[model samples]
Target: MGWNDMQPLLVQATQETLWMVGLAALATVLLGLPLGLLLALTRRGGLLANAPVNKLVGTVVNVGRSLPFVILIVAIIPFTRWVTGTTLGWQAATVPLAVGAIPFFARLVETAVADVDGGLIEAVQAMGGGAWTVVRKALLPEALPALISALTTTVIALIGYSAMAGTVGGGGLGTLAINYGYMRFETTFMWVIAAELVVLVTLVQLVGEGLARSLDHKRPAAASRWTFRRSVPTQTSAAPEAAETAAQETELTGSALR
Candidate 1:
């Protein structure tokens, strides 16, 4: 296809890709966050610890996470149809995409929450805080940066999975690449779509990194440490000068007395 002919198709495909990825990411977060918290909190020594419950949830997550994305898409076609009343568009594609993503994202969340300091949780408990309070005030807040990073990684992964969905007639840039680029032998179109995907992923990574860095208070604390170091030398230099001046004054007073 000529550049002029491909523009509209590319635009529509790009929009479809975004729709699939955006909705799926939202679903992943909604379902995964709480599930992940459960996994983290129900562990052996966790606040709500229950060995059986933890093991069950972990096994479920592992099973979901173990399935290959393509196979998962195919395996869930009936469920997709039941959910969206169709199996060949952006909406239907979301079912598998979201399902594939939820466990992955939940695991990431588990890791993020696990990384929270035991001391902080203990402090909260000592202050008469409940489990929910510890999670809300200490765990979530302390792990916000890591959680954002994990979300970023998951979003990027979703973008790739969305492209894979195109192979199954799930409508997106991947579909465009497959139908127009590969099947039709339109190399130029394929290259353009590939470039667009690359650009989209790059932008997502940059934004994720920026947001994570912005939320990280350690950067400011480190900067303050540097400022303290810079100021210390001046104080030390002034103290020596002050001591010398005091000694000189004392000698002058003694000479005058003599």
Candidate 2:
């Protein structure tokens, strides 16, 4: 068929691809980010250090990472069928897509959060901050840029996985390429779809990189914000400024006395 005839199919496929990838990416973040945080915090010398727990989680993540996506998708077919009540279509595709991505994304997140300065964590803890406060005020904010990079990587991987899933009745550009281009021998249309995939990936990569750079560019101001928030005592936290800023003014007072 000509491009005119294939236009509708391509459009439908594109929408399906977006739907699958979007939902899968959301799931990846919801599940992966926390898993990553767990991995980071449970390591030896980490905030919640427990060797056994860290080892267990690390093993699981490693296994997840080791498995090839294509095999993982097929291997989880039963689970996918149970979850979505079907083994085909974009909706069903998300099960494996998310399953495949969570571990991968989690690893990236673990690395990102772990890369946060140890000094920051120490500073937070010295203020009598709890684990939750340390994570919120120190780890997450400081590691945000790297986390963005991790998220970008995860989304891009999801796009690729979504396309691969399409080949197995997942329903998207890959299916279109297979059904029309490869099966029907419509070489020209297949190339067009190929072009579309390239453009899609390129756009996503560019946007992600640009956002990361923007965040990096403003890191100085962001760092100042973190410092200010931590250094200053506020009325709202007067009762338990220990968790946020208990020791902040002591240095200033000591210096003034000198």
Candidate 3:
């Protein structure tokens, strides 16, 4: 078929691919982000350390990551069908795509969050901040750039997974390529589809890079270490004690010199 004939097909297929990848990415974030945070926080010495929970969560994430997308989609066919009421089309494809990617994204999130400087957490805690407060103010803000990069990686992976979804009647460019290019021996279709995918991935990568770079403003090395107010408490309840301690220290130093 000529470009005139294929134009509509290409547009529709592209739309479907975007829909699948976008929705899956959203779901991956909704579920994956918290799972990742939990994994990071529940580890030994973390803000909310729990050895048992950490091991269980880690194992589950590992198992989920072990399954390849192709097999994962097939393996979870029943669950997908149950979720979306059909195992065909881009909508249905999102179920498995999100499920497959959640663990992957979560792991990346854990890595990113884990890399945040421990001093920031300590600083927050010294200010009388709880785990939730530290997570919100310290960990997330500091790790945001790396998290964006991780999300970029996950979205790119979803694009590939979307292509694989096409083989199973999950409609997208993958379906078009397989149905027309490979199955029907239309070499032109194969080339065109491949080109489209390349362009799409390139655009995603470029945007992701821009965002990551823009947010990577965290200070380098020792500068990133926030000076924790360990001796003087900042809260209203602790102010009196901090003043008393300061006065006592000053008096001791003068007495020693005299």
Measure candidate 1: CA RMSD: 18.7
Q: Which ten residues in a row have the lowest lDDT in candidate 3?
A: 222-231
Q: Tally clashes: model 3.
A: 0
Over the stretch 1-258, how does candidate 1's per-residue lDDT look in tens digits?
Answer: 788999999999999999999999999999999999999999878889989999999999988887888889899999999999999988899899999989888988998899888999999999999999999999999999788877877887888888888998999999999998999999999999999999998678656655655566765442332433443344452354335534643443233222
Better of 1 and 2 by TM-score: 1
lDDT for 121 (candidate 3): 96
Ranking by TM-score: 1, 3, 2
List model 3 lDDT by residue over 1-258, tens digit each: 789877899999999999999999999999999999999999888889999999999999888887767788899999998899998999999999999888888988998899999999999999999999999999999998788878877887788889988998999999999999999998898899999999998677556644654566653521322212321232343355336534643453233222
Each prediction's RMSD over C-alphas, in Å, is 18.7, 14.2, 17.1
**What TM-score does candidate 2 get on C-alpha atoms?**
0.83
Q: What clash pairs does model 1 have?
A: none
Q: Which residues of candidate 2, in runs, are more than 4 Å off? A: 217-258
Worst 10 residues of 1 by lDDT: 249-258
- Model 3 segments more than 4 A misplaced: 219-258
Residue 6's lDDT within candidate 3 is 78
Put down candidate 2 lDDT per residue, 110-227, tens digits, no spaces.
9889999899999999999999999999999878877876777677677777878877889999888888889999999999999999898766755554455445534453334243
The model with the greatest lDDT is 1
